[model samples]
Target: MPLTDAKARNAKPKNNQFKLFDTDGLFLLVSPAGGKWWRFKYRLGGKEKLISLGTYPEVSLAQARARRDEARGQVADGIDPSQARKALKAARVQNESTFEVVAREWHTKFTPTWTPGHAVTIKSRLEFNVFPWIGERPVNEIKAPELLMVLRRIESRGAFETAHRIRSICGQVFRYAVATGRAERDPAADLRGALPPVKPKHHSAITDPEKVAGLLRAIDSYQGSLVTKCALRLAPYLFVRPGELRQMEWAQINLEAGEWNIPAEKMKTRQPHLVPLAHQTLEILRELHPLTGTGKYVFPNPRTSKRPMSNNAVLAALRRMGFEKEEMTGHGFRAMART
Candidate 1:
């Protein structure tokens, strides 16, 4: 059926469905739910296939027919229409201007001068904090207030440190946008005093000595699991951050050598760290081996069965031991050890 304007209007929905066929290798498929769509059914690589021609009357029959001919030409050229369409879609996505694009470009330009940790920190801040807010908006179109809104959100959570970091990230992104001619100037420059400062007490440590002694005793007293006992006993002996402790790979620890070599990438410094396994640390490792030595990570999370132990897994054990947050933290052992 050659669908003219009159035919289109005359086409009726039956039981909430309609069909048009026998033109431009297309059958207009109408959903029982009230959406009229065009589909071209054809043979490709000896397999019958269907390609959507979008919806009509927004996509008129004439437009559907035009698209059918284009797809046919692609088939003649030995290119699958689906793949061709996918390639075209990808090209269009690449061509579209977006905030992610500008931010990445900004990241590329500035990351070379930054330490690896700084680069990672900046990227993480942008991905979580800034990109969601204005990464999709045109850099030139972003207002000061809009940028402030992003930082204020971080401030609201009392993550003032992260908020300041986002401010720096925004400044870098906007500068990159300006250099690349995507934006006019950095709107983040004048917003220094816009957010609350991070408090001084959040130095990422456990504060009380008496509580820590109690927590240590609880770890020693823990009889629920040998792995937990080893981890708790060795906590202070290998006073690396909790993350460094948990990400301990089997290959990284040498029981005979009495050392756990934390690779730089895993360490906060991104430099290889030598954990001098005191006799106490090695003794705990020996016991931990019978339980988890068969796995790659020294302490794989029992619940996940794949990843390193949960970051809070050890901390949670402390919680179960009835330790208060201020009394002891996973990092508090470091403070106690360092002091």
Candidate 2:
């Protein structure tokens, strides 16, 4: 007989488990503990098998009958419904594992080789750009279109280079997922030529000897602070990165040896660097030493003298000297010296 809701709900439990047969081997099993379970009794390859559809109320009589009909159709095609159910459940678990979960796991394994700042930057980039859009989606199920949509949002903000970098980062995460069996393939790898090209932008520099001379003359006559004036004067001689120069510590400079021994941590490459000081550079350092020698930084902030000089100090000085941003930046000294 087909089981109705009232028949199943009013069914009494006994000292032993009992089954109220519905039809075609679908029945409601009422346990001694008063729990009702919907189950399908079936046979495959002439051997008997049982599959649990769901519990009562959750799996109503009509829903259980529908599932039974579907399973019956599968059995008619000689497919084992129990095995099919197991595969579906496993797939569901895998899908719930999620992109964010796998990406974070990949990050944890990979961050050990990265510097603290680099690690923080990568995590921040993912959280800001990728997380809100599709981070919760299953990594394996994410298609190229979905990822391109994420990149497009970044592109819309005019962060073309950032979008490219994020694509690369996502590729790494996807590859990690693939290698670890969390995903089947990298969707990001399928997105070649999808983003805008990233052009290399070199810092503007005065490389011509004549223009360089003119720039030096302008720096000398600048009416900025004496400390800033000295930094501007010394920049051309040292020719290190602007941040490296501004964050320079007194201890790193060997005025006697005419060399600045930049520690690996302070350098962009994470490798120690040597900057040979010219005679004029030594004189400038010696002259400025009296003013900032006692402080931790060679070019301490003018307002406080407790920290390194502002990152904009040299750039602002260049602006004041009539060198437009396209003409020069604090970083331009490297190219100028290289030239």
Q: Which number leads on lDDT? A: 2
Candidate 2 C-alpha lDDT tens digits along 1-339: 567789998999899999999999999999999999999988999899998999998888999999999999999999999999889988887765688888888899977666577889989999999989999898888999999999999999999999999999999999998898788899998999999799988999989999999999998899988788988998888778888888898999998999999987777677789989999999988999998999889889978878888989888889988999999988899998677
lDDT of 1 at 108: 83
**Residue pair clashes in candidate 1:** 16-32, 99-135, 264-270, 264-271
The weakest ten consecutive residues by lDDT in model 1 span: 198-207
- Best of the candidates, TM-score: 2
Count of backbone clashes, every candidate in sequence: 4, 0
Name the TM-score of candidate 2.
0.66
**Cα displacement (Å) at residue 258, model 1:** 2.9
